[model samples]
Target: MPPPQPRTHKAKPPSPEPRPSSSILLISPENKILLLHRVKTSSSFASAHVFPGGNLSSQDGPIPAPSSPERHVDSPVYRLGAIRECFEESGILLARHRDGGGMLEVPDAERERARRAIHSGEEKFSEWVKKMGGVVDADALLPFTRWITPTSVPRRFTTQMYVYFWPLSGAGQDAKIPIGGDAMIPTPTSDGGLEHTAAVFQSCATWLEQARRNEIIMFPPQFYLMWLLGKFFEEGKGGAMELRVQREKVKEFLKGSGANGVPWADKVMSPVPLGMFEGRAVLNLDHPGPELKGSGRRGESGHVVQVRFSKEGPRDVEVRDAVEMKRLMGEAKGKL
Candidate 1:
């Protein structure tokens, strides 16, 4: 008898780590929801559909206390960050007084004080909450879904999803501050924040129906939320009742996850299609797969080319160059 030969195999590479991000699922009093179409820029997702959110800042932690509860306005420090992000991204604020008063009436000096403190890192969100004589009611935000970006991509995010209900009173008016940059304008009553180049309020059923029929182009997160909304629509009710139920469902879902769930899931490939032509290709950022094909044409001095996909599909993304198009298409192929 002879000793058996030892066996050896290749070691697998370590999986890539995920990044962190945050988003809000805001529902208005009329049962309408807010959505944003990302700007078409290298620094942005480029026409991708998304909820109102961004990477969480260090200022999102805690804040100082005001002299007294009665003197405080708005929400707590951390929550105020969420409120500010909502206002900046979609022009919606989740603040309300226990006495049923409006947040708009909050004094500019106090609001400005809190804003400056947070932005300057002079205050913690918790301290700010205490100063405002308010509580950081995490309950106000219902946890929804968690998503992570794929390791193959240069950019990634580990995101937490939160759902908030905006009453009928908060649905119609827009905040006066600018959305992204320093420019200011009258806030649009709907979701017309500066960051949101295009915003709309529609029922989950309408959004889902359009998406299912290929009338709307949406990223996975938006599509998934819409699908969830469709489930509520089937119950045959509309307005505040439906919104409340959805909010509760989201709350329950978050509570049930406990501590074992991942902070976010990897970004799923777009569900649409892709194409390659004339040294250039078109990729649909909303959907996955390579079966879909489209054309790209050089414009003006030919320094830039416009890549278009799906003649009637809801998603229409324009890639700047052949290199980018090829890289994106390669990613799509790898997913397949």
Candidate 2:
């Protein structure tokens, strides 16, 4: 016996953490964005007006079709989930025929059928996509911001928000109907009467105003995004092409930062220290808003990021000083 084999220990790999989720900000051809109103009785973000999205599903896995932009970075999963959720909640499909036949051109009647089927769980989204011989148009989804739910929140979700522009049909010479901007409008729908009760396409500024008035609720990440979108539109960067360019700029800016590089996965998942915002760079973390102190959940700490929406467009994002932040908001509001 060869000296009875010496014992060796191997390190155990870390258990798989909960997977991340993705959301879509559907921007219409005329510059409006879509939002869904969560039912009042729900637990997480009850009665909050949020973007159209939900947790990823295994049904969103790979199929035998070609998708525009192929995959989102290294996986086709998130993009497919986003498309399915959007279709389920809003009755809008962001896909095209695999043969390059352009966006799915289904009649309003068929659209309702698909929406009802998926919403009821009677039909899996992937099966429907395959049956139609269409592909998820991931190219239309421009990467926007990354956000993580705060530690104070019991159930945390790591979410990536994408901007998808609803292209004009381009069939008619004069077909431009502006959906909305800066107002509190209700979209109570009975179609996807499951997770979501209604959908709205409010102007960014108006959405903030509604939250302030206690008409609807908003969590930290949602409010932050609306703040940026409010600036983008209020300063007239609302055009489709203009907004697209700005989205790319923001992506590059975040990528340039080592701590917040492309995918931004590392920084976005961890808790953002209070001291990290001293440099005024892109810190994609959640901090409770001072303005909403008495109203909104306090989040991890008593902190907020106030941005300056200049005539040139979102000039700066500031998170320090209570008085100064209020003053800046006043100035921005006046200008808007």
Q: Write the per-residue lDDT of candidate 1 for residues 13-61, one digit (tens) a residue.
A: 6544443356777665545566776655525465555677775565664
Candidate 2 at 57: error in angstroms?
Answer: 1.0
Candidate 2 off by > 4 Å: 1-19, 62-74, 168-192, 235-336
Q: How high is the CA lDDT of each candidate model?
A: 0.47, 0.56
Q: Which candidate wins on lDDT?
A: 2
TM-score against truth, every candidate: 0.52, 0.63
The model with the greatest TM-score is: 2
Clash counts per candidate, in order, are: 28, 1
Per-candidate RMSD, Å:
14.8, 12.5
Give candidate 2's TM-score: 0.63
Deviation (Å) of 265 in candidate 1: 13
Model 2 agreement with the true structure over 130-222: per-residue lDDT tens digits: 687777787777665545554544565556577776654321111124333321112223345576787767667777777655566665466
